[model samples]
Target: MRWILLAISLLPHSLFAEVADVDLNEVSEQQNAMKINKCCEDNELMVDSVCRLVEQYNQSAWIPKFKTEDGKDTKVKHYRFINGIPRCETTQQRPIFDLGKSEDQLNMLSDGRLLHLIHHKHSTEDIKEDLSNNIYSIHENIALPEEREPASYIYEQDKYCMDKILLSNSNITGVYALICVPEVKINWRDTDFILKKILNPLFHAIAMVLFLLEAIIYFVLPTLRDLAGNIITTISVCLIVSQAADLVRIFTEFSNHVSFMITDIILYISLLGAFFWLNSFGFYIWKTFKSRNVFLRVTDVRKYCYYSAVVWSTVIMMAALAICAHFLLDTGTNPNRKMRSHFSSSIIDNDIEQETIGWLGIAIFFTPIAFTIIFNVFFYVTTLKVIKRINIYGRIHYKLKGCFDLFLQLSLIMTIAWLFLLLSWLNFDGLIYAHIVVNLLQAILVFYVCVVRQSHVTFLLRKSCCYAEPVPTGEWGDEMTHMNGGNY
Candidate 1:
C-alpha cells in the first residue's frame, strides 16, 4: 500500500518532467545525460561565483575554469538558451545551434523562447563532449534513411559554407555551425509572420527607387554640351546596370523562397549586367580619348599607331570574358540562401558545372593580366603625348583635357588595385586588409574624379570671368550689371 501511494505521488511530477528525447536507450545518451545534469546542477549552485567572474568582463560573461579542445584551460563566454526559448537578453545572441543542451532548450529556442543551457565563459572537456554529442544528435538524420540521396545535393552544404557572399549590405565569406538542435515543432509567432511579410515589400520599394534614380540621371538630366552629356550618359549606364542587378538579386531572394527556378536564372543574369557596368566605364574613357586625340588631332601625337577600333574591340572581348568568369566562379553556392534553388545542382552537377565554369574564369583572369600590360603601356604613352601637346598649345585651362587626365589617373589607380587583388587571391587570409585598401582607393579616386571635376569647372568659370572683364573694376558699373544678369 505504501509503494502504491509513493508511485501515485511521483506520477504528477513525472508527467511535467522534460525528457531530452524519447529514445534515451542509447548508451551515450544515458551516460552523457546523467553526467551533464550533474554538471549543470553544480553550475546552478555556483551561480554567485560565476556571476562574480562574469561581472569582471564587459564583452562576455566568464565561465568557470575549464579545459579546452587542446586540453588547456581557456576563458571564453559560452552561450546557451535556458528552457529552449530565448529571453529578451538571450535572443540577441540568436544562437542558431546548441553545441549540446537537452532537447527542451532546442525546442524553446526554435519556438521563440530564449531557453538555452549556457556554460558561461570557460572551456572544458566535459562541455566539449556534451556539445559534440548534441551536434551528433541533431545532424544524425541529415542523410535520410532508405532513400537514395539526390546527386545534386551531394556537396550542396559544403559549397554553401565555402562560397563568398554578399549579405544584407555586408559581405559574409563563411558561416560556422556552432550548435545543432533537432527540428523543433512549434507554432509560429505574430512577429515572425510580420517580419516575413514586410521583407518582400521593402525589397520591392528599394528596387523601384534604384530604377527611378537611374531614369532621372540617364534620361531627364539636362546636358550642357555633348561631352558632358556623353559622360553623364556613361555614368548613368553604369548605375543602371549595377542597380538593375541589385533589383534582380532582391527579387530572386523572394522568388527562390517561393520555389521559382526561372527567377534564379534571371538572378544569374545580374552577373552579366555587372560586367557590362565595368565595361561601360572603360568604354567611356576610351571613347573620350579617341574622339579628342586620334580623330580631332587635339594632341600632337602622330608617331605610334593607336587604333580606337582595336582598343574598343579589346574592351568588348574583356567584358564578355568577365561575364563568363562570374558564371564559372559560381561564388554563390548557399542552398539555404534565399533565391537559390536548394537543388540547383540537380539540373547540372555543381562540381562539373563549377569546373566547366572555372575554365572560363582562368581564361578571363589571365586575359586581364595580358590586357593590363599591353593597354596600360599604350594608355600611359598616349597620356604623356597628350600632356606634351597641351603644353605646346598653351591651353593652361583646358577643361576637357583636365577632365580626361582625372579619368585616366583614376583608371590607372583602379587597375593597380585590381593587380594587387590578383596577387592576394592566392593567400585569402589577407583578403580583409586587401578589400579595405581597394575600397579606400576606389573612394578617393571617385571623389577626385567626380567632386574635383565640379571644383575645376567652378575655378575655370572664375578664371574666364577675370579675363573677360578687367577684374570687375572694383566699382561695379556695366561689369557688375552683366554679372547680375542686367538686373540693375
Candidate 2:
C-alpha cells in the first residue's frame, strides 16, 4: 500500500494543471458578519484563546461610599476591576474600565467580571462587596501544597481583637486558628462617678463663684489687698483654675473613661496650683511664729515674692518629674488606663487614677497635698505654742487673741475635712459618701470662715463698699500692716 501511494504521488503534475484552484477567498457575507459579532478584539486577561470580560459601572460598585465619624461622606477605595482585570485600588487615580461598552448585557455580567473563565460578582452592597477578595483568595489556593507560596499583596481582617473575617479558601481555612485575645476589663468607681459628674462640678462651680467674689473684694479695695489679701488672691486664682478644669472635664468628651495625657497634664497643673497656695499659707504661719509679730511691711512683701518664686519653681520641676515617671511606668497592672482611640501605645490616663493610688497620683498630686496638710497642722500647733509662750513670758496681746482663736477653729475644720478624705481610701463605702460631702462643701466651709466668721475678711468686704473706716476692734485694723511685716 505504501509503494502504490508513493507511485501515485510521483505522477507528473501537468496531468491536472487545468483543474481550477479552490477559491478560499470567497467566504460568505454571513460568515464574515458572524466573525465580527463573536470575536473579542481587545481583552485584558486572555488565556487558552478565551477572552475575559467585566462590567464597567458608571456608578461606583467596587469603591463604596461611606460616612466618616467627622461627618464627611466619601468613597472607600478598596477594590478595582479595569478591563476585566480584578485589582486592589492602590493607585491614586484610575480610569474607567468599560463604560457605555455594553447595552443590554444579555450575555454579559452586571457588577461582575469574568477572570480565567470564572465569574466574580462585585458590588458596594451586601455579599457582593467581597467578590474580588473571595476570588483572589480562591486563586491563592491553586498553589501546590508543597510548592513556594505566592507572596500576597493583601491581607484579610484580623480574626482576634476585631470582627471575624473568615475567607473561603482552602489555604486560609485549613491553616487558620482562632486565637483568644487577652482583653482587659475595667471597673468604674460608682461613688467617684457621682462625685466626678455631679458633686465635684458643683463644688468647683461654688468655689469659683466664691473665689471671684473674694478676688473682687480684694482687688477693688487697695487697703484690703494686703499680705493675706495677696495670698488670698493667689488661692482664688488656683481654685478658679482647678474648678474650671473640672467643669471642662465634665462637659467635654474627657468625660469618657479613657485616659488622656493632655487632660492629665491640665488636671495636675491645677492640682499643683492648689497645693502651691496651700504651702504658701503654711509659710505665712511659719513666718508668724518665727517673727513673733503680726505685722509686715512693703519690703517684707517683696522678700516673700522672691520666696514664692523659689517655692513654685521647685513645685513645677517636681510636677514635670512625676509626669515623666508616669510616662515611663507600666500601664498593665494597677488601675489600667489605656487610651480609647489607640492600641499598644502609652498615654496618660489620669492625674489621679480614681480606681487606685497610682504612682503618678501619689508623686504628683496626692502625696504633695498630704504633706502640705500635715505641715499646716504643724504650723497651727507651733503658732499656738508660741502664743502660749508669749502669754507665759509677757502680756497676752488682746488684739491678736481673737484672730488666734478663729484661726484655730478654721484649721481644725480643714484638718478634719482632709482626714476624712484620707480615711475614705479604706474602701468603706460609707466613708466615700462622707468624703464627698466634706470635700464638696469646701467652698461653703471657706465662705463661712473667711467671709462670714473671720473679722478681718468681713472687715475687708465691708471696707470695699466705702464704709466708714473704724480702727478694727480685734486689732484687725492693723491686720494688713502686720501681715505685710510692719508695725501696727
Please count the clashing residue pairs in each candidate, in the order shown: 25, 11
Query: Could you estimate the TM-score for every candidate?
Result: 0.35, 0.49
lDDT of 2 by residue, 42-118 (tens): 32222212333323211111222233333255443232222222122321111111111111011111212111111
Residues 127-245, candidate 1: write the lDDT tens digits. 45544444222211122333332221111111111101112222211111212122222224543322323433343345445434433432332222233333433443443443344
Give the winner by TM-score.
Answer: 2
Please identify model 1 stretches exceeding 4 Å from their true place: 1-221, 228-356, 365-373, 390-397, 420-427, 440-444, 456-488
Q: Against the unseen true structure, what C-alpha lDDT does each candidate score?
A: 0.34, 0.44
Off by over 4 Å in 2: 1-200, 251-259, 292-300, 330-358, 392-433, 466-488
Highest lDDT scorer: 2
